[model samples]
Target: MGQGKTSLVQRLYQRAVARYWARSARSAATARLAVLRQQSQKAQDLRRHLNRVIAVSQSRLALPLIGSNSFPRPHGTDWAWRPELWRQPLDRVGIASVANRESLGAEVTLFHDCAVSEVTLRQIRNTREADLAPFGVSMDVLGFDGSFLSLVVDLPDEAVRGLKRSHVIRLDTIVEQESPLEIFVRLNVKHGPNTEQVVHELPVNQEVNTVEFDLAYTKLNEKRVEKAWVDLIFEGPEMNRVILRDATFSRRPRAEF
Candidate 1:
């Protein structure tokens, strides 16, 4: 049953209680006791109905994770085996390191304060990859003391050549901070003789947030978009750790329903 049905039953139960109270005023003691008992029974029936509906709703939502012929495990030592409810896709990508000591990739690097501990990059594989290549990409970075962390991803000309022009670039981030912090997304576009760099600011409170960069508005010289790179800059107080789960580019932009 849906929420509407549950609400209707609750309303009916309240009406029954009211009717019982009204009749008890003039009825004999035995009759009043019977009326109270009936009201209790109706309340119990509503509670049972609610429980059944909730169970059905949860089962429906979990159908995707609960594959055929296997029982779903709530938690496991392997992170991938854990249930989907606790997984945050954006916090799953990139490469993780401690302080500014480790390089994420050939073109990517991380730097952070020693005080801020535990930074990670994780990737949440989309449906296509989950069924075909069941693996996740992640990076964990830890900061000690106060430090600056930067991530640089090199995008070669060949990489962007075939990319759809109407795509949306999305970044998922989780921030753990005692104070407010400023995060930056810098885009550097390099064409043969021309180079354009743009920086976007993302301010994060003590909350998890998702930021989307719309590339459609970016007037890239379609013919000269030879090479590009994105730099994520983090600057803030000590003990501020940020986790980046996923960064994805999709050709489909969200439309209003």
Candidate 2:
């Protein structure tokens, strides 16, 4: 028998059993027993019919079973099963650091190299504003040999001047080893030289630190923001590596509370 024929028979048998059960409730006790036996016989016949159909048509079917092995059994029941295609582990390696040379410009590439030696990068979701957030974007150089390391960012003049209110600029740093460090944040506005140039001293021995540059209290003209840059200056000690995990610039509206 074919699959189609077998399915038709099964459906007819089920319908017959249902109809008999519904009518048998009003029948006598002996009639009820006879109806039950007939239903059981119908179920057995259906099973036999399906077996015959399988033997003749050579159709495939799946059956779940128990196993004692570490891996679970495949969802299907086939003799020629290939385990490699469906049951295999996936690689879960992650990237360290990334730099956008195009945006940084060609002239600035010679001064510094963006890398991730002892850090990791990840993508963030469900952020309030932007879709993606950067992780492990900063660098921590040892020995402080480099003379100048600056990041130049181009911005629209309208956005710079529109920032009349105070905002918080955050920089995340991790100190692998101890050394004296000086950090400077300078904002270059449009039609102006350097507006807000503030220098802050880092701690001698600290695990992890977060440096926040508040633009509210500073002498920054938010209405004239055309080109901006951040300069990181390291002073003292000839050997030490600072791991900058991440740096983000976000605006936090002043709270009344």
Most accurate candidate by lDDT: 1
Q: Candidate 1 residues 182-249, lDDT tens each? A: 77877766766776566777765634444555555666666666776677786753444443423422
Worst 10 residues of 2 by lDDT: 77-86
For residue 176, model 1's alpha carbon misses the true position, in angstroms, by 4.7
| Whole-model lDDT, model 2 | 0.40
Model 1 worst lDDT window (10 residues): 77-86
- Candidate 2, residues 77-141: lDDT per residue as tens digits? 11111111011211321233323232222111113333422222222111112111222223334
Which portions of model 2 miss their true places by more than 4 Å? 1-161, 178-194
lDDT of all predictions:
0.50, 0.40
Q: Local error of candidate 1 at 66, Å?
A: 16
Winner by TM-score:
1
